[model samples]
Every structure is written in C-alpha cells, then in structure tokens.
Target: MLSLAAESWMLYGIACVVLICRYVSRWLQLGSVSRYQIEDYIMISVFGFYTTLLVTMNIVVHYPTNLIQPKDVPNLTPELVAARIYGSKIVVIVEQTMIMTIWGCKLSLLYFYHKLTFGLVQEWAVKIVAAYTCITWLLMEVLYFLVWCRPFTEYWAVPTDNIQCTAATHHLLTNFIFNVSSDLFIMCIPLPLLIRSKLPFAKKLMLCLLFSLGIFVILCAVLNKYNSFKHYNNAMWTYWYIRETSTAVYTANVPMCWALVRRIFNLRAFNSPDRNGIAKLPETPNIDDVPATIGGGEFRKQTTTPQHIMSAE
Candidate 1:
C-alpha cells in the first residue's frame, strides 16, 4: 500500500530533476536560444503539469490504498465517500493533464525532429505529415478528454454514484493506439537520414538509440494500460498513472539531458553545444604554431612578437 504512495513520486521526482537539468544545460550553453525555443517552453509546461499532478495527488483524498472488499463498502462514511467522489473529479482533471503533459513532451520531440529534418528531408509531404501528427495529437487526444462524455460531470460520478457512463475501455485503447503509433511515426522520421550519414556504423547505432528512447515511454503506456485491468483500485491506479507520466516526461527530456551528464562528468568528447549563430572555424594548427623548443617538453603557442618588443623584453 505504501508503495502506491511512494514509488511514483520517487520516479516523478527524478524525472523532474532530470528535465530541469536538461534545460539548465541548454540555457547555460545557448542562452535565450535554448530557453525560448518552442520545444523548451513546452517541456517547461509539461514539467509544470507534472508538478501539478504530484501536488493534486497529495492534497486530494483517495480510497483505501488496498483492494476495496465488499465489506469495506459499508465502512465508507458519507464524508469519506464524498471526498472520494471529489477525488474522482480531480482524477479526471489529472487524466486530462496526463494526456496533455505526455503528448506535449512527445510533441516537443517531434518539433525537435521537425527542426532537425527541415532541409535534410527534401520532400514536402514528409514534413507535412509530421506537422499533421502534432496537430492531430493536439486536436484529437487532448480534446477527447474534454468531450468524451455528454456531460463531463457524469464521467467523474461513476466512482461514487450509480451513474451510467461511457465505456472507458474503448477510449483507452484508442489512446494507447495513437500513443504508440505516433511514437513510431516520430522515431521513424530521422532514420534514413541517420543511416545515410558519413558517420561510422557505431556512431549511427548510438544516434538510433538516442532517438528511439521513446520506446520506453511506449512500454510504460502499455504497462499502465495492462495494469489498469489488473489493479482497479483508485489509489493503485493513480500510482501507475504517475509512473506513466514520469516516464513520458523523462524520455522526452533525455535526448537533451545527456549534455548535463557530460558536463557533470567533465566529459569533452561530445563537447559540442550550440555556440550561438557563430560558425566554429577549425583550428588549422601547424608544426610552426607549437613552441616545442621549450625545455622539459613544456609547450606554449608561439606568439609573433614584434622585433622592437622582443628587444625591449
């Protein structure tokens, strides 16, 4: 029972920290270019939504974190039942927020791809499809939560009242269907480009893994859907939802978060970061550029000193 309360938040906390680190690293590297991008702002909004989810979960009253036995129904007082009913309303909001947060993060990655594949993908149709996918998620899934029921209150009352409600099963299946399908669409976009790069086989494989990390988010969506059937308890289900939310946000941020990890470890191999609009000129160093004549193998760059300046020195 305690695991229900603790585990999701633990994961959410880590995800939140990692998301922050990703942006912090970006801002440190690119200033406003990093801070103000549509993708970066969307991630911040998603993190805000995730934070609201955590707060609402703690503040609202939920059911007995265990299975609701028939005997326990009698023990449920009017106040407890009312609070639980109110919690149901909050859960509906949380569910909507979850869809938004998860898809918002996903859209951010898609937008990243949109920018990434701009000139790289020459065909207009491919870019149109990617844009349409983001718009479809925004219009179809997000609004589906708002209008799924004829009267929205009816949707929340099912937990506490004997109200006839639409089948959530169908909506969930549709939700996960789009979830995984869009995931496939986004993951597939840059593959041909990456595969054709002059980069060696190992580097290409690493890029593939980075882009395809969303598979874990898809896995979480699958597991959460599976758990929905096995654990019908409200509190337990809430934990699963939180896990899904955290994984969504975490996976979305990780493509950028490696920069933070590299910095913290003093790693330089992948030291590349956005250096603003300036193009990095290659260091065309030659043998004459090095002062190898210095004693004890100590070397300094050879500076061209004027003849008069050298004589004065």
Candidate 2:
C-alpha cells in the first residue's frame, strides 16, 4: 500500500506537469487564454476529477475495505466492519471519479477531433463517434448504479456474500467493453484524415504516432482488468487504476505539447513559414485551410502563427 501511494502520487505529479505544458503550449500558440479551445477547458475539468480520484484512492488504501478475502471476514469486529464500510463508501467516490476522469479524457479527445476534422468530410465521423462515446458512458453509469447492485447499499454492505457487490466484477466487465470500444472509435477519427493528407510519409507517420498514443491507454485498461481478475484478493488492481488514468491523461495532452517542444528546442521544420509569408504544406495545396497542430484550432484573423498549415498530419 505504501508503494501504491508513492506510485499514485508520482504518476499524478507527471500528469500535472504534462497538463501545465499543454496549456503553456496553447497559450503560446493562440496568444491568449481567451482563445483557448473547448478541448483545452475540458482537460482542466478532467484534471480536477483526476485529483479527486487520487485523493479517494489514497483514502481507500488507508482504510480497510470489504474487498478482502473470505478468511478475513470471519474475524471482522464492529470497528473493523465500520472501517470497511467507510472504505467501501470511499470506493463509490473513487469509482465515480475514475469514470469521470477517464471519460473526461475521452470527451476531450473527441472535441479535439471535432475541431481537427472541421470543414472537412471527416467531421461527420467525429459526430458519430462522439455520440457513441457519450451513449456508452451513460450505459456504463446506469449498469453500475442501478443494475449491478440492487438498492445501491449492497456496494457497502458489510458481511455480504455477493461477489458482484464486493468485487465489482460486472462493473469492470461492462466498463472494459465500453471504455475500450469507445477509445478505439475515438482513435479512428483522426487516422483516416492523417492518411489522406498529402504530407510527406515521415510527417504522416509522426502525426499518426501522436494520435495513436491512445493505444497505450487501451493496453493499460486491459492490463488493469486482467490484474483485477487474476489477483482480486491482493488488491493488485489499484496499481493499474493509477497507471490507466495517468496514461489516459498523458495520451490526451501530449499531442498538444508540440508547440512547447518546438518553442523550447527552436525547431524550425514544422513552424517555418514559406516565402509567401504563409504556413506551407509541402505538397498539399488543396487543404491549406486545415490547421496543422493537433490541438490548437484558433484559426482566426488575429492569429499569425506559422504553425497553422494544411493538415494536422
């Protein structure tokens, strides 16, 4: 548990650093916080829920919980039972915040894709994926709160024999299905556009790699569920929970940090303007209105950043 707490805080710290870099990149690119897009604001809210998740997970670790082996149930005194109940209550908050944090990341990515595909044929795909993501989230919530455990109190009921209430097997399964499927849908949104763009093969691969960071998040989700099922009695799932959320936060924010990377390193390849004083896509002349950066889409008249180009790829 000590190690788990340490790992959680460490991952949270890294996530905070990346988030700061994301916003700084946005500010430098857009020239002001007022010009920040919807995805930027969504990430801020996601981080708020992520912080809550970290605090609640630590509280769960500090207190004993009903999620223990059957052997431990025989020795449960009133004080231990009460502590377990308290921890179980905290588990409810933890689950909610975890869902919020993960789904918030999904929503943030969807918004970014919406802007990325705007004024293009791929915009319709974004809309469809956005609807699917939202619907799955709602279904997962309904299954968790209403279907899985009856009357909502079984989740914290001490001395209960229901594994569904104690171990949350049903919740985990449904969440796995919805979460992974939605992430795949969201990931597919930008790939086709990147492929269709006439950018050089190397740049296309780089952009695809950036958008494909969600693959790590998806892998973490799978490993999280696998460990939870394999070591249900040992609380091994807690570590993966931290890892999955941190990876999601990282994947969602990293693509936006390119501006900061370019600024700090003085990289001229992507940000250099052409002789006509406009951002140039080497061979793609048909889509010059499309923004080049993954996250920033403030293509207003006042903006003169040469990073804006034909396509995100």
Candidate 3:
C-alpha cells in the first residue's frame, strides 16, 4: 500500500538533491571549496533536522503501513492490537516533532533573508521580525499539542476510546492559520526593500521573481492548513500531510537553488553596470563613504582624489 511515509522519503531525496546543488554552486561561485558562510552552516543543520524528521516518522509507527479493515477487528490477534496502540503513541510524538522540523526551515529562511539585507536600520528591522516570529512559532507549536491534549498521552487514547480529550478542530484550524500567515509574512518581508533597490529594471524584475518563488511555499502552507480537516482520519491526514510538509521543505530550498542557476548560466546576474556599460569589478568599500546599499544591487564608485602639486612661491 502507498503511504505518506514512502512519499515523504521520496521528497527527502529530492530535497537532498536540491541542497547539494545549492552548496556546489555556492562553492563554484566563490572559486573554492574551503570558504563557508554562516547561512551555509545553518542550512546544512536544517537539512540534518529534516532528515531526522523523515526517518523518525517512518520508524516510529510504520505509519504508511496498510491497516486491516475494521470489520476484522474481532479476528485480530492480541499482539496486533497492542502493536497498533504502541504505534498510536508514537504518532503523537511524531506530530510534535514535525513542528520542530517546520520551524527549522522557517528560521533558516529568515536568517537567509537577514543576511541579504544591509544598513544598520534594515538589519535590525529584519532581526526584530525574525525574533518575534521565532517566539510566535514556539508558542504555536507548544500550545497546539499540549492544550489540545492536556496530559498529552490522552491524544492517542481518545482517538479510539471515549476518554476525555480536547476538541481538535479549533486547535487544528488555529495551527494552520498561524502556519499560513507566518509563511506569507516571511516571504513578503523583503518585498518593500527590494522594490526600492537601485538595481536596473531587469535586475529588479529578476530578483523579485527569484524571491517571489516563495509564493509556492505560501501555497503549501495554505494547503497544509486545509488538510487539517482530516485530523481525525489518519489515512486522509497522511495523504495530504506528506505533500504539505514536503512542499514546505521544497519551497524553502528553491530560492537557495539560485546559486546553481547562476553558476550553470555563468551569469554575473547581480553585478551592476559601470559608466562604460561594462560590469563593474568588485572593490573594497570604505566604511565612511559606502552607501547603505548591498553590493549586488548597487555599484557606487570608489572615491578618489587627484593629488595637487604644492610649491613654495
């Protein structure tokens, strides 16, 4: 039987491929394998966490396993029933862990966005947004699980038995709402600053297109919330959840793939034009004279003064 676990693993492979391309292209751009940026480390670590989430989901419950029809419950072996209960418990934990996986991807994107911005004012603004988003994500993840199933073990038990447990629709809706909104906000945060950049019309259009790719991530987040309607049905939930979560990772990695695109095309896409209609060569900017703009978006000429001859007359 096809299972969400199988599908998620497939997406994991795809994510790894994209990440490999991102890293290789980055190194190629720098003309060296030794140099690494802070975002590179964070992305690698996020991929590690993503891998763990995929692996854990499959191992804990064999969640993708086909179930015997309910009519056959009376004929089931005691061992099989016990196994199902154990798997159910594991599912609870897996759901909780999934939050961490999603948040890791979001945080990685936020850091990447922060790295791309310049100016002390802009940098702090992005940092503050990042910090507030982090706090909101943490709180959402915590409350979604705990408040929804106080004495957390009850989530698994209540699914099959009539034990007291919180209603899930509201919680699911709340979580999905937050997820979609956050995804949209993060993707939109850079638009104003980018729109105001001094880049040429074509460059600005291309950059916007590059960042606008996150609109796919926003779609994934919306669909993710839509699928929560099936929260009580594992088969339906797994079917949609796999796509939703995988898409989260997929969208997160797509923008990073720009490095590979640039490398493959041998395009100095970010370089600005010089006065002679040639690409400006890179130069070290003096702190005092440098504009608050980042290099790829603007090419301010280095200030030079001609020497004046002085003679005693």
Candidate 1 worst ten-residue window by lDDT: 287-296
Task: List TM-scores for all candidates, in order.
Answer: 0.73, 0.87, 0.74
Q: Compose the digit string of candidate 3's lDDT tens values, residues 15-122.
A: 878888867765654446676566667777767666666666676545322133446657656566666657666565556556666777778777766655533235
The TM-score of predicted model 1 comes to 0.73
For lDDT, the strongest prediction is 2
lDDT of 1 by residue, 1-313 (tens): 5665577578877986887787776654444553457778888788888888776766543433212355667787777667656666675666667787878887787666554543332235357656766776766655455655545566545233322222355567667777788777777765665555443455457767876777888888888888766665444556767878888887787766654565687653221222353322112211111010110011111222222111100
Cα RMSD, each candidate = 11.9, 5.1, 7.9
**Mind giving the per-residue lDDT tens digits that candidate 2 earns over 1-313?**
4588899999999999999998998777667889888888899999999999988887787787677778877899999999999989998998899999999999988887776765666678989989988999999999888898886898998967878788899999999999999999988988876676545566668878888999999999999999989987665777888899999999999988876887798765442354556653343322222235432222311233444433432
Measured with C-alpha atoms, the lDDT of residue 289 in candidate 3 is: 12
Which sequence of candidate numbers ranks them by TM-score, best first?
2, 3, 1
Error of 1 at 269 (Å): 5.0
Q: Check candidate 2 and list the clashing pairs.
A: none
What ranges in model 3 sit over 4 Å off? 1-6, 29-35, 56-81, 158-167, 230-234, 272-313
